[model samples]
Target: MTANREIDSILQRAADGGRITPEEALLLYTEAPFHALGEAADTVRRRRHPDGIVTYLIDRNINYTNVCVTACKFCAFFRAPKHKEGWSHPMEEILNRCGEAVDLGATQVMLQGGHHPDYGVEYYENLFSSVKQAYPQLAIHSIGPSEILHMAKVSGVSIEDAVLRIKAAGLDSIAGAGAEMLPDRPRKAIAPLKESGARWLEVMAVAHRNGLSSTATMMMGTGETHEERIEHIRMIRDVQDLAVERGYRDDAVETGQEIGGFRAFIPWTYQPENNHLKGRTQATTMEYLRFLAMSRLFFDNVSHLQASWLTTGKDVGQLSLHLGVDDLGSIMLEENVISSAGARHRSNLHELIWMIRTADRIPAQRDTLYKHLAVHYTPEDDPTDERVVSHFSSIAMPGGGAGRKQLPVVGVS
Candidate 1:
């Protein structure tokens, strides 16, 4: 009864918009009933959004190059710099992909890639400049702190200079990739060569200070502890608090213009298929849902929380709406990194709308900045565009044909 009372008090405080400590969050995450936790999280979600709308984005993950120097063990996408299969997409190919995305009503393109040794700040400047010059409509939400650190070192420039040059060269925003686990233990175990978690936050702090807004992400199920999970949230919350304290909130009260800060938090599970870190423990569906609820309840300052349907499958994605997920990540036209790691879940715009509606919420299409572009209230108002389908890539199967398929076991060479 005493434990129950503690849990109830924590739930009440969280649902009422009061802040809960990391210890309270862990208790709710580990001890509270699943339905109760989800209910509290849903209440918090409704309070934050207030409009019964679940949002999604229309975007494509365009990996520029596969050649990488820091080959993390949890990755199945990167190839060594000297590998024969290591190839960088040419400028024309990238532009063609952008054209395809634009034609399909996509307003954002995630230009992620490996950290090539020779690619310096100038390479990214030219790439961003050319992309913006060709398609000014497409938002280049690309790169992460890891890439920035590497590029700065390679180009012999400071981190601030690297961020400023990229932003000036039309790099609209940064993607919070490479933040697998913020804690040092698990992070080093999986990605020893990557920048430390504190360093990652430092880089993001610099970006936020320089007017570059970005999303924050956490890669779970990578052999991390419950305490570590809570610590991750704590770290993010502290940084977010700092961002606000430094006058980097979503809106400038004086000018009414947007400023730099984290716009959303996305938590995805680690895929353990063809990577070097295979045969490790993974997060179950229930654990994922629990974390989802806890994140919603804990991240009071963060505005949006996205559901990773790409990693956790479609059913859980739908259920996440009830567990405090306001956004169902994206209708990814192409995703190679997660797919290469055995994530086979895919969805089209139509299916996503149906999923959201089935969850008893309105469906809305949002842009990179979480601005709604279109809202579907009823079936009569549903979009009729058939081209918005998940068609480009599929999980690697034994035979041919790339239909809606499951992941097949491919041996790591």
Candidate 2:
């Protein structure tokens, strides 16, 4: 309860822009009164963004392939090499997907996929370059450290080389796609085949130094302990600190939006629907709310925090705004990875705006770097031209599509 001396002291300290220790964060996460904790986090949010505008991204998550070498137990989206469901989407389909994204008002595309054995750095070099050539307006925010590592190894090049080549090929930034859990226990339990947590941080550090910014992410409820969860954010906060010291640029110093390093921290609850783990463990709504509050208070240096409506559902996603979330990631014209794992929440442009409005926050469309593209302060100001991506569109679930086609698996609830 907030009446408790320790809770009151810690919450006030955090809300006042002071950093909380992992021990203090863990205590608050487990024992603080729900409303009081959320209110404190909201206070922090107000301090960071007094504008009271909630931002959303208009983007699609388009995968280029589904064949992956790392068989993470928690992933329901990957297929083994040459499996009947495995695919490397043709260049035409990739271009078509991007074209669709642009027509639907997308300013960015998250181009990610399985780490296919055959996809080296050159593969991405060509894919990214081709996409940029076709859609120069769409910012390409894609891939994580693991995928980059796989690509680098497959290409017989170093991590730095692979990153540099991709940047040249039009990778505007890196996506925090594969950062499931930063601590060793959860990473080992859920994604043993994936790269180490330390190495993951190293790759992001490399991206930051190379002038390619990225967001930090965590997938909770994958059977890790409470201490491990707190430790995960601690690890992220530490890396963020390191990134600022080593890679910070003053590109947007006037606006206080640091140009490089980790720009946002997005924590989403893991989907256990059809994965190997089989839903043995899950994070409750209560657990998730606590994480939202704790993360905002813990990451004073990170500029933004995002709520994952795609996985947590819209109601919880809306509730997150009061608990320190400033952003709802995207409408995601096409998403395969999490949807294949059982995330069914979908939104249209107007419905998403209404969600933000009903939450008593100004709804704004934002670019990749958190800049407001358009701020809708009143209903009349809302854009009527934006459209929605159907949840039951032509995309098919894994194995449901026609034979060996190189395309994405549409999520079926």
Candidate 3:
């Protein structure tokens, strides 16, 4: 059979709700017609979600610490211990941030931070417990694999034990961070002291087995080849398969299904700003959208595909909703990690609803776990009632204060 015919057959099978092999996925990634692949993926997305109603989660990212040990080359946000600028937010301050998020209608708070030398399982337990105790309504969905590995060493606890303790402390779910590139060659080159690709998957598997569902992510366009990009997806797929297998064996959920597993797959491009890999090529908007669509097509087991509007701008993010992405990530009231890494794009709830409606998708406010809270068919349908008025202020950062203005809303051109 011709290569094109084989690719078509694979696409057909995937459309029919069947999983495609890695070889087939590679073909689609490499040779499948761009528009054809997009259309095929869109078909699958529409079938699963007939409304094409793209949604954005209501949450905020709170980077609790910038002091880090494993200084990955691609990171522009982390500061070494010796660096005077490196700092960690105290628990009170962190809780204050959570209170602010809750006030702004953020139901989930992403507690991201660098691997501080002194922080360990006890520190996280106290922090998570404190957050849960204060804001019982807010879900604590935070931490990446790198932090988990570092904390296990610092606390002198086994990986399984650390994860179990954290789960017990009220970690709602895990975020797939530090997955710069799943291929070992690039991963080792960037983050030498960090955990191996397999080890990262192992940490996540333990979390899944312990009844914690998390999202998977990939950081692309960071000097890795296109083939390596496909390999990243393949790696996540393999990890997800193993996670499901373990979850089923352990009966991680009461229903005995693959619950407490990977809930969504999110792929975003690398940001090169003040990092070591300066002057590196960044992922273009089209490349990002194409990859977003391919991700929806590739990760058959994953249900929700989230577009990183925080990394890519809102327009492409809006366009991505039609290209098979169902989630627009979070409406981050304040995000330092990515924004510090040169992601200048910003959005608020008003602008968020405008973007969603402009794309012809109903805007629904959702919680951390993707549970629907409210829907807005139009601005009139919005229930916020109290509009968040924009004002001028200055944000104090490690460098200096950058004045804030009203969030921009560029009309459709």
Please give the lDDT score for candidate 2: 0.84
lDDT of 3 at 62: 75
Give the per-residue lDDT of model 1 (tens digit) for 19-112: 9999999999999998889999999999988889999988878888999999999999999999998989899988888888888888999998
**What is the C-alpha RMSD, rounded to one decimal, of candidate 1?**
4.0
lDDT of 2 by residue, 99-173 (tens): 877877889988888999999999999999999999999999999999999999999999999999999999998
Models 1 onward score TM values of 0.94, 0.93, 0.91
Check candidate 1 and list the clashing pairs: none
Candidate numbers sorted by lDDT from highest down: 1, 2, 3
lDDT against the true structure, per candidate, is 0.86, 0.84, 0.76
Can you write out model 3's per-residue Cα lDDT over 139-218, one digit (the tens) per residue?
A: 88899778899899999999999999998998988998888787888888778878888788888888888778888888
| Residue 381 in model 2: lDDT | 91
